[model samples]
Target chain A: MKILVCISKTPDTTAKIAFTDNNTKFDTNGVQWIINPYDEWYSLVRAIELKEADASTVIHLITVGIADAEPVIRKALALGGDEAIRVNTENSDAYYIAGQIAEIAKHGQYDLIFTGKETIDYNGSSIGGMIAEFLNIPYVALATKFELNASKAIITREIEGGEEICEVELPVVVSCQKGVAEQRIPNMRGIMAARTKPLKVTEPVAFESLTSIISFELPHAKAGVKLIPADQPEELARLLHEEAKAF
Target chain B: MPVLIFIDTAEGHVKKASLEAICYGAKIAEQLNTAAEGIVLSEVKDDLASLGKYGVTKIHHVNSVALNHLDAQVYIKVIAQIAETTRAKIIVFSNNADGKAIAPGLSVRLKAGLVSGAVTLPDTSKGFTLKKTVFSGKAFANVSVNTDKKIIALNPNAYKIETRDGVAEMIPFQAAVDDGKVKVTKVTKASGEIPLTEAEIVVSGGRGLKGPENWGMIEDLAKSLHAALACSRPVADAHWRPHNEHVGQTGIAIAPNLYIAIGISGAIQHLAGVNRSKTIVVINKDPEAPFFKAADYGIVGDAFEVVPKFTEAIKKLKGIA
Candidate 1:
């Protein structure tokens, strides 16, 4: 089985978010980059587990970004990807990125495709379904569990108040989240091997972005907290009802 | 051309988020000086015409049982055909699970610009700019859609529902129904308790609660407030709570009216999931817990001592037994 896992580089979870150039671009001066946690801990790890179950399973990693995304992709490789494809581009629009990855998936002809539910940066959660549409295949979002049998796969996903189990044929796209797999750390051997693994770079396909960012703005800061004395817990409730009207 | 709204339904009932979507679509229609219409594919128990009160003039019903459960591929095919037939310039959806599943695919199929997590009406005066949350609500971005056809998925609870005394004309529309390749085998519904995403008030706990054994106080507080229960990532990882109840950047991001955090230090990751809340109250023993910075109210006291009293105070205020 051939599986394509899509990953992206995002600011580390603890990075202080700020925008520069009049809020048109994110300031990368002191930002630390890492593999998006959902991609690393869930999508890529699940692919690694699938590969472990079947010796013939091949896992290929793909990302749409510039040179800066290489380190993050290498970290994914160390976690257990067989090969990597970089659609070298700086555009981060959801449609443009999905189109680029769809182009690669068409050529790769993989049986299954995987993506994190959404990138922590964009938080759009749209790419997986867009790619599936572009490729004309079945798409499943927010899968918490996945099991494979022969040419079919059984998947379970979270809904509003419960879980729904689904079965789809091969050549389907699935967006993964937590509960799909546990996190894995790369050992010394995997890290050394990743340094020598093939890192293929390809130019992006010509496509126009349907949407453009006009500007960015920071969320309004909260006013300083009102400290209610520990002894006056009732005052908090009274304030919630009278002043804040929270209830 | 009218603005089209996708009315989502589950268990034969219209979803609250879809009501918000209808109100949003109506306001957009008012801005564009056009009519607002709706389409529902599921088997609904409510009178379709009654939804007109939410600002829709007409509702196209497919009345297909196969669509009761979401089949994204099938829904996309049907909605795309409907959009084309109606020549809809704008499409609206509630950015919930079903919307997240359908809108992106429909956008690609129709070659339309799609904006998810929209928080406000589009600024049609100067092109089509829409405001939406980005970076998990840490910031906001104004996005412009250059496409002739545009789609907006409004976040749940981001817009208020409006009602008027009007009945919509219900038109039965004919469309092909296909179950597609994906088949749902079984469904296990979480019973009774309110789902976290839809909860207006959320009470969450973290490791400072010490162990699962001490969760009774947290439960008592949540019960008194009639709020849904949530936990931090560590609590979920430690198996103290279900993963679904874990609210953080990596878990489900929730935007509630009021969020009360007990013993959970406000890490940036945890804040990302909940900073959109209208009000926050933090209770912790440590005076310098990071959560205090983002809170609207803080009480520096141990949860064992403070949470019970807080619950009692709320009960007294509400006159609950």
Candidate 2:
């Protein structure tokens, strides 16, 4: 099966989120970046799993980012993907990115496309679905497990009060979630192989430009802690009603 | 022909998400000056006509046992066929699990402009622009639906259900049903008094309660408030609570109206899942802890010491103590 895994580079989870130029753009100064955790954990690893089960399988990882994203893209290639493509541009708007992906998927015509539910940076779970729309294929989001047969793939996902199991035909878009597969670390041999792997640099097809990032701001700060004596149950209750107005 | 809402049901009874979807679709249909129609999957116990209260004029029923369960591909195929047969301009989903799975699939099939996690009605002044939450509820974005066919997935608890006096006229539509390859094996359910996702009020605890033995306080507070019980990732990892009870970025994402956190220090991952909650109350002994900064109400105190008293007060206030 030909699988296309879309990936992104995001700020490391431990990075102190900050804004630059009077809260305009996310400040990258002193921030360490990594492959967005979802892409790393679910998408890349799952693709690797398929490749391991079938040596003929081709898992291509694609990213639309500036030149700086090459290292992370290389890391994803090292992790499991057989090849990598970097759409060398900073046009990261959901639409433009989705369009860029649609261009690749439309041209390549991969049998199966996989993405992590959302990027840790943008946290927009809308892209894979949008790409699916752009390509006009079936899409299943937040899939925990998958089983691909002759011409159909079965996806199991969690739902409210219970779980849901769905089956779709081949050539579908799927956004995987946590526990879809265990996180895998790159071995020395795989790391070495990744260095020589075919890394393709492609200019994205000209599309509608992105909407500007208006601004970025931190969330409003909550109130300071008001400690009540652990032993004083009455005092706590009184505070919930009289002051907090929560009760 | 207009707007089609997928009315979800279990054992033939309509789910709350379905009501929200109907209201959302009907309101959107009103915006477009088009009448709203619905498609019920299986043998819903509730009368399809009763859904008229939400302003749906028609309920297209294809009573089948096969559709009692969900298959995203099949639903996408069937809904697309239905949309094509009816010539629906816009399709709306609840942005719940089924919506998350099917909306995009349908979008792909229909080649429609799609937006998920929509919070408000579309801005119709120009081309159809939908506002959705971004950056874990910290920001909003306006996405334009540039395609001829448009698909939208509305978030639950984001839209209020509007009910009026009207009876939906039942219409049976002949749909081509296919038994897909997916089948249910064993369903391991979390048997709880309250499921975390559906709970309006949630009382969650972390290491602040100190140990598993002290969990009684959190449970008592949750019970007193008739709220669901949840824990942070650490607690679930430590096996202090079941895995299903964990709420965080890596766990379940919930946006309950009121979230009460006791002892949790507010990790960023944990906040990502719950930052959308309307009201947050944090109770911890450490006043300088990070969670206080995200809390609307903070009581700096030990969980074991303050929770029981807090529970007693609510009980007394409600005259249940």
Number of the top TM-score candidate: 1
> Taking the candidates in order, what DockQ does each have?
0.83, 0.36
Restricting to chain A, the TM-score for each candidate equals: 0.98, 0.94
DockQ of 1: 0.83
What lDDT tens digits, residue by residue, belong to model 1 across residues A33-139? 99988889998999999999998999999999999899999999999989999999996679999999999999998999999998888888899999999999989
- Ten contiguous residues minimizing lDDT sum, candidate 2 chain B: B180-189
lDDT of candidate 1 over B1-321, digit per residue (tens): 999999988788888889999999999999889999999997899888999999999998998888878878899999998898899989999988889899999999999999999998999888999999988889889999999999999998799888999899998989988768889999887777777887888999999999999999888888888888999999999999889899989998889889999999999999999999998999999998999999999899988988888889999988995
Worst 10 residues of 1 chain A by lDDT: A237-246
Q: What are the clashing pairs of model 1?
A: none
TM-score of chain B of 1: 0.97
Residue A30, candidate 1: C-alpha displacement in angstroms: 1.0
| The 10-residue segment with the lowest total lDDT in model 1 chain B | B189-198
Q: Assess candidate 1 and give its TM-score to the true structure.
A: 0.98
Residue B224, model 1: Cα distance from true site in angstroms: 2.6
Residue-wise lDDT of candidate 2 within A1-247, one digit each (tens)?
8999998888776677777786667778998878877788887898889888889899899999889998898888878888898888885566678889889889887988888887765555767876876776667777778777777887776766655666677788888876577678889888899999988999988876323344455656555445555566677567666776655
Model 2 native-contact share:
0.34
